[model samples]
Target: MAGAGGSSWVPWYEHASPVLYLEQLLGNVLKEVDMPLEERDAKLKFADRLQSLTQKAILKEYPNTHTNVALRGFGSFASGFALKGSDMDMVLMINGPDKEKLNFKDIANALKQSFKADGLGVYIISNTRVPIIKICEKPPAWFWEEQEKLETQAAVEASAFKAGDGKNVVGDGANNSETSHSMTNAGVSGEHSSESEAEDEEEKEARLRRKRVTEMANKTNAPKNSKVWYRERKLGKSDFPKSDAGILCDINMDNPMGLENTHLLRCYAACDVRVHPMATFVKAWASRRKINSSRDGTLSSYGYVLMVIHFLVHIIQPPVLPNLQHPQDWPGLQDLLHDEQSQFFADAINGHWIHYVRNVDALNYYGSKNISPNTMPVGRLLTEFFSYYGDPISGGHSWQGHVISLRTRHGGVLDKGEMGWNRATSEMVNGIEVRQRYLLAIEDPFETNHNVGRTVTNEGAGVMRREFKRAVSILRGMIGRGTPREDLMEEWVDKVVVDEGGQGEGNVGRGPVATDGPLSITASLARIGM
Candidate 1:
């Protein structure tokens, strides 16, 4: 009944601390932007169905060579930072074939043909370093139902086998006869006849138990509506068409590093409950400001997430998050470092060592220890975050000639010149010359050679810098005026529209200024030296 800011018309400055008000505002925004539980479950189920269909299609196409195929979800979806309308990032692992020898084009073509009749849209992108197949729509309901049936049967068979001796137990009359014929072929005629008869009786009882279980399952799990009740119950969705069909998925054959990074982020997120909400809020803010697209020469969502993590881990006092990748920081990881069998062992990917503390349970409450606990509210942390990156004089990070490296245990800042990413360079990509810039260098945690901010162009970097400054200015103006939390949030996320006459300063325009009273807002910002 009360809107996001509450029922009070009075400004927050009149009754509460501005920092507290800001926190309440951020919490409200998260409530608005956070993905609903039903939606999250639906997307996960869609991913499962997609993986199943992909494995089935690949195996059917290359029945002889391909032994098994597996699809793994990664990126935001896997890392628990996914928001509404987020696309699914997945990696496809193919067994029983040499990865280099496998033709990506052939595999893509085969998949396209297999899913053509199912009304699924598939496209192969061959121009990139790693060829990928993109699925634009959810598979038909029948496809999902087919996979569910196979899973149920496999589960029943496994249960029945486990109930008996570990040997392969056939549950049908034809298989029993075949087993008897096989025993006869093995020359078991004289004294072993009694043993064979006893074995037959045991197999018959096992078969009957399996039959009863299957019948009970069929009766209880039968679909009442057009949708399968089993899947609906598992996924917590009445129907899957709407929530699942909007998910765009990309399937790549080789991306072990991506999967590893996804797991690392997931571990970091699990360490602190606040980590996810902070990262998600930053991503949403960047998206609203139009600075989160890497394709158009700006920073990616992944890059923004790294920035947030870096702030919490290195910039803030006592640290809100520990550097999970640093073994020295986490003493529990020392023993696991040398153990090759342990999950903490370094994985060699493309000449880079990918190592991190995989045991999240051990790292829980790492930041809030006896020495100095970082129990800052999310609102205050956010304000500090914006100030640290946006206002250099106010102890913000100096992005110029520096790189944000989460792998570095101390301060998380690396010299761009030392990392050899200070200057712009050009390389051949798909037989075409592409220039790589390090204007906003943010190193990949595992792939030390890769700069996540290489996609940012000079103009894009300027645009991002201006956005940061504008955010600081708006916060100062709103807080100075004792604006309501809801109003402050609205002003922070409102898009700046430049006029067609090109009369604005650095893309600032007359469109959608901070508040209704432009003069008071400008005066407040000027007083803060913005």
Candidate 2:
């Protein structure tokens, strides 16, 4: 509602409408498709099969030592996916992964090949799933080899019971009770020794698999700071910087926040949206949320994911809008019920936990007083927004005025709700800061990245609501927390000083920036709130 649903200057169609479309799309698609009871069971079985392929690919991809690191250090493996049309939705992710290093596509390809060998089509679809958002929209045999890099490599190595899919975790132990003891021979001790060696090899393989999973767990640990962030969400760290895990929101509960929320909105934004794991080439896009940066970049292939979800819908039922012109009409506009994109939407609705919940209020939607949609291209709506962003911290405890810390033009702290004029840096707080960057800039369409920022230093809310991503904000908080200047990186504080042509801390440069905007500080785009 405030600033065109968080942007007064911008059109509501882009920012607010997408949210509605996403929710509607999900609903309609589910109603139409998602399959019969038998089909649902079959797809679940397929999902199980796909999971195996991906795990094997990971084992083949890395050497024992490297695989050990991936599994033990980061807990790397192919997690899972719903399996959309002509594509495979998979994630080759490491828990606590450093988004900067890992390329999501590579991981998907590895698993894709593993599946291909098993006779499954290997298409990488984007945005079918949350987080590991990438998918293979069907790979050619020629490319299968390239994609099979992991699987091929995995072929050479023996497999173990443990695996790492980044999101989930399992110990080194696997269920191989059937072959518990080595077969011993009464006549030949040497043969028995060989048998013992074979058993030892099996044990080693099992350990390797567990190692793979454990390493992945460590890698995808949501950045070490996530723990601290989780705490800050519920308990302000003024007196205690770090503490034991409290009632922190997991942001992991197939969370309505972040990717799940963003993806749903995206479906509405596009015309045949899909929900494949590779939705919108999730690797890079989803990476935006973590690494304390992951802001929706200039281009977030919103179409891929949107279409995939749409495709799934059709597989189950008729399209939401029979003659659908836009995805927003999905599930509601009836016309879309027969649309082409229905294939994707149908499955998502039936398979996923998507439906219309009338209970959410404005406070729960839009996170803080309507800010810009979480992602670009596909803006978010208030109703669906709450599903992802719940009730945020409200009242006097939060800092109401905008603190324009980046550019000295307004001293990086703009109060008085200037967002009415410039929708970028400023926003009206409904309850709490449910997202990362407040506003990139206040210019029309936010064309260039010359906006201001709102500091979440004292904002009250959940752990994920307070993702610690931006270096400026992080540094600002650190400085507030008395982080030593000598130990601090100059790239942190020195970057915040910007004037008329200065950059803002609130909106890290995702879109093109105006020459007149604030200068970017030493750090790159960042996000703190989960």
Candidate 3:
């Protein structure tokens, strides 16, 4: 498929091939939509600060307590796949007897009080299934005042520098400099006549006055620093209903499985160069199709990540990644250790489940291997991933029909019998009763009994499969015979512009999707077919 350019050179499928078009498409989409590095860094830094402040709050609440308080993140932030403005998920670990004595409700109350005392925004969602304190920091009055002062000083300095160069900053005659100075601060450039200058000044004054009024009204209506303040003032405090010390709390701080899973996913990313890009693209794609939230009866981002890892480990020929938890060929001869799977996740506490991954062993084994035989272009892998998950309606296997397990390190189908995942069996996972739905079985790498895909409904799964086929159709068109890549890209732009807000039912608060119908991509490919 050579273009107008002259060449004795044929396209190399892996390197200098037509697949490069797909690569560029994915890269450009990611660059335009994904979170920037600076934003990610700033969010991470803020998370760190929040964590530190939370720990200090706990210590302040209990000065003489010997309990060990540790705050660890567990969501997209910890997993390194965070998008722009993703919420932070943190687990406050209270080890020692304090965990038993100080319940989640108590901790939530203490945290709320402490955060509010510092004027930080805090919402304690203790009534939910998982109690969590959502925190955000707003600029205090002094902070905004300081920023305004800095901006004014910089603007004055710039005006003075211009004046020293012997140029009159033109504006209204008497208030010319003043108007020009204000205009400069507002990032307006050009000379203004006297009448226009007066109008601008009046508008600016009105805006400032309105802003001050709004600030004053907000301050007047602000909540008291603590509940005790209302009590001290005797301001309707007697009529207020009293809350129990630890009522309606749902968070399980003692459990570390969620945090450990985040670590495992991060380790997978660290061990493989392709994992991050591939996972990110898939997550973004799922978001675009509106199938990334478990709360809405679809798979979570983590579930999609597990699927990518499974494909890399088992589905692809020669396997791009080796199974880190595989118990094959003992590297360090701890002679006592016989079985691999059992030994890896056998840790527990007080009959409660605990998982500890041998990160060092996993990294050393998989990171060092040369998988050149398995190496494929990222574009092809992405294409195959969509095709595999979104096989046509006359399907051999779809995400809804079959389970994707990373535990199946060896290439083949894994039956439900092997893993013992079904409705008949039930187990207490981190203090919650978990039963296998067999709907979209994704075995938790560490907590093997837990099904991360239990949230995926039949409808959600169907939507995801259809979207997969749709993506395959789109990509195939771009690489199809006699189709110019630029023409296809232009079509993509046009399609997005036209279909901006009209994405079909069950699609709201999600990334973009195409309303285009599916065509035959799997039938056309000769070398590989899902």
Best by TM-score: 1
When sorted by TM-score, best at the front, the candidate numbers are 1, 3, 2
- In candidate 2, stretches whose alpha carbon ends up further than 4 angstroms from where it belongs are 1-31, 66-89, 96-109, 123-530
Tens digits of lDDT, candidate 2, 454-485:
11111111212332222223223332233322
* Residue 392 error, candidate 2, Å: 26
Best candidate (score: lDDT): 1
Q: Once model 1 is optimally superposed onto the true structure by TM-score, how far is the C-alpha of residue 429 displaced, in angstroms?
A: 3.9
- Candidate 3: C-alpha RMSD after superposition: 20.7
Model 3 Cα lDDT, one tens digit per residue, 121-239: 44433322334454555523443344355446546755886779654433222322222222211111111111111222333333343344334333432222200000011111111
Q: Tens-digit lDDT track for model 1 on 55-94?
A: 7777776666735578877777787887777777777766
* Count of clashing pairs, candidate 3: 0
Off by over 4 Å in 3: 1-18, 128-130, 139-252, 327-346, 349-357, 360-372, 392-396, 416-437, 482-530
TM-score of every candidate: 0.67, 0.23, 0.60
Model 1 alpha-carbon drift over 4 Å, by segment: 1-18, 138-245, 330-343, 364-372, 478-480, 484-530
Model 2 accuracy (lDDT, Cα): 0.27
